[model samples]
Target: MHPALIPEKHPMCGKYMEALVQCRKDNRFSRYIGACNDITYDLSLCLVKEKKIARADRQAQWHDQWRKKKEEDEARMLALKEQAAMSKSESPKEVSSEMQQL
Candidate 1:
């Protein structure tokens, strides 16, 4: 296969891509009989590896963001609970003061 036909998504496989291209050029006739098979296989494997690494990094980042959002939500809920508790504690004094006046 021509190097130009290869996808550009895997920078890590550039060397493998070059090797395959060279093999094809060196064995223009033999290439039709599997002369570049090994190079092509190696390039495919490298691309697969790069893809897996990228997916893992993306997953880790997503998990970190999700954990941070959950932590912030918990803190906000705790703050609201504390605010409610404080208001409840102050209500009885206000009610008693009103009763005394009545």
Candidate 2:
């Protein structure tokens, strides 16, 4: 499995659906094949539900990281602008002469 694609843990953590499927596959309830099939179907539904929850959690984390980085960048830009403004105020004549020279 690709490292990025691999789930950190079984997607069905805390879910009993896998155990139900395994019991059916193992023929634990041999007397009723219909019951086994029903259990398997239920397991499939649980798996889908767990996967959706995991996917949403991962997306939320990704967006949070992006938001934090964006905020840091904006703060840095504002600091730089403030520093430039302060320096310009302290040396207005020099800056004006330099602009004329340019």
* lDDT of each candidate versus the true structure: 0.85, 0.68
In candidate 2, what are the lDDT values of residues 1-102, reduced to their tens digit? 111222335555334445554665678668275656665565557667777988999999999999999999999999999999988887988888899999
Clashes of 1: 0
Model 1 lowest lDDT segment of ten: 1-10
Q: Model 1, 64: alpha-carbon shift in Å?
A: 1.9
How does model 2 score by TM-score? Answer: 0.44
Q: Assess every candidate by TM-score.
A: 0.58, 0.44
Query: 10-30, model 1: which lDDT tens digit per residue?
Result: 578878887887898899899
Evaluate model 1: give its lDDT: 0.85
Task: Report the Cα lDDT for candidate 2.
Answer: 0.68
Error of 1 at 100 (Å): 1.3
